[model samples]
Target: MSGINWNECSVDFGEASYPYYFGEDCLDRIVASMAGYGADRFLVVTDDNVLQLHGEKLLPALARVAPVDVFSRPAGDGAKSLHNLGACLEQAIAAGASRQSVVVAFGGGVPGNLAGVVASLLFRGVRLVHIPTTTVAAMDSVISLKQAINSTHGKNHIGTYRTPEAVYFDAGLLSTLPSKQLRSGLCEATKNCLAIRPQSIAQMRDRLAAGDLASPQTLLWLLEESLEAKCSVMAQDTYEQRAGLILEYGHTVGHAVEMCDQRLRGSDGLSHGEAVMLGMLAAARISNAMGALDDAAVAVHEELARALGVGTEMPGGLLIEDVMDVVRVDNKRGYLTVSGEEAAMVLLGRLGVPLGSHDLPLTAVPLGIVKEAVATLVPDNQ
Candidate 1:
């Protein structure tokens, strides 16, 4: 927090407001925040893992306010797809969840985004309270109103922007996460920090190099700063019409990596955060080639990866063409200046800044660069 600059890059998206309760016992704060709204019954939508880990705090607190029913699915990002969405809705119905009941997404991004969409769709929109479990969800995905169910076409191919009534982040829960998961979550934070507050990137690298991820206070401070940075930007473009596109800096390549890795197949594979780390590296290279990002910025990212124990390896065995296909098909590209232009051919520039509409030479980015990046990022030293 000390190294983060709040003045120059602060972005206020607009009038949209949602309660974001941070710190410990935030679950209790969630109930208190929603008490005034008067929900008679509550339906908590979560993953099996999170329900086992954190549901106790939320369910009991929610029960204090009203009758609470817990509905959970198997863990993993794949559970957020259409198949699970249907099952979740049916489960909610069986549990007597009604239009009047509040639906709380009680896990990370998958649960939060999925539950928010279900709430929006169920009975033409039920009230939603988002309780983000991971560091990334607390900051980036939880604030965005977009909810989605993936398809064969791509990730989040079917989704909408249905903002939750509130978002509660309890940094206390971050302690239980595995080191890999912690690094994964930190990828989003790193992406945001690199774009807006470059110094934050430096601070995080220093902290991680000093072995701070194991410290709850350090994680919380970093999470808070990251969330504030994103929230400020989200307030400007909740609908992602204009300024919001900056949020997609690393995501374009990130999603492609996830898609190529078949993230839907298994949790043992690359996580959303893991894929993003690879994506960020590739995007950094793109930025470098585009002349927007310099060696210094790229070095900062590389240093952070090593410090945080995040894998900087490029995903090997992945066909660049296949990954590019997913990139073009990504929803964000539709909002870009060259939607009609092939995204496979587009070179994504620096983290914060946009590269103007110029026909990028896709082949110009030698496969060797990606291969070298992959060599650096592979789980095992190449």
Candidate 2:
């Protein structure tokens, strides 16, 4: 821990609060901190790739503190299924895990989500800890209490909100990530800038162009900025049901495009952040048509997308209809009342200002207009 730069932050949920610790090259400190939870066992849920890459460095340190049991699966969104959730539960039970067992999520969003459900359900809820490795997990997923697995019909359909006892991360781990994987989290951070903290846009633009994304300074800045942006909203609306709905900025159409692309290309498809970036483009177009967001704002979205190296257009082999089909069942629907031809979405009136009331940061836009916006993403050949 000598070389590690320890930074501590707290998440206040009104009902509960917990600490989040992060630093570079700090696995030792992380393990030591997790041990202080006073658990009889550690149930580590992770993916095989992470296990192979960082497990030896982390698991051994954890085992020294308490009995550790690993429940690992293949990497990707497919692992977030009811089947795998059950498998993780059975594995924990078979390992003789007790009520004092600490469920430590040891991967990115997928494993973090699955572990969250497992912890919430096991023994009527146990202490949960998140040891996120990926930028997406470190900056986005682990910051909130929403825990869930994807349903066959939609993403995060079967879920609950369970806060972790603590969250920890090491920025050093991100150095090994491929460029696309690194950009995935930055893209989510980009959403935060466009919707929640537009002032950070200048810093983000500078970093994106610097082309040294893997440096500890850049990763730490992204994490801290994301924390400030997301926590500012989530602290008031813990479940992300009211004012926090603004966080869903591009997710409405983005999630739809993401699911459709997954159906077409599996894990090889567009990343969650890339899809969200594309969804922002669609949302910008929709906003412009509604005379809420001007063309200049729309162009800014494209500029950021290009700078982030995410696709500015819709993914190949995907049709506008396919994305629309998924959009019809978007989870944000209940946030507002809309006709059958309208979809609930978060639109921007200007940078950092979402176009809706204080209680609900969403609006109902007609399906025809949604289609018109999505049409911009369609490939010329399609």
Candidate maximizing lDDT: 2
CA lDDT scores, all candidates in order: 0.67, 0.88
- Candidate 1: how many backbone clashes? 7
User: Model 2 misses residue 192 by how many Å?
Assistant: 0.8
lDDT by residue (98-181, candidate 1, tens digit) is: 778888888788788788878988888889887778776766777677788777667788877775676666676666777777
True lDDT of residue 181, candidate 2:
87
Name the Cα RMSD for model 2: 1.6
Every model's TM-score: 0.83, 0.96
TM-score of 2: 0.96
What TM-score would you give candidate 1 relative to the actual structure?
0.83
**lDDT, residue 231, candidate 1:** 68
lDDT of 2 by residue, 1-382 (tens): 2255798988776576889998888888888788788889999999998999999999998899999999999888878899999999999999999999999999899999999999999998998999888888999999899998988777788888898989988888876788988999999999999999999999999999999888888887988898898888877788999988888899988988888888888778888898899999999889999989988899899999999998888778888887888899888777799999999999999888887875788988999999998988888776
- Point out the worst 10-residue segment of candidate 1 by lDDT: 2-11
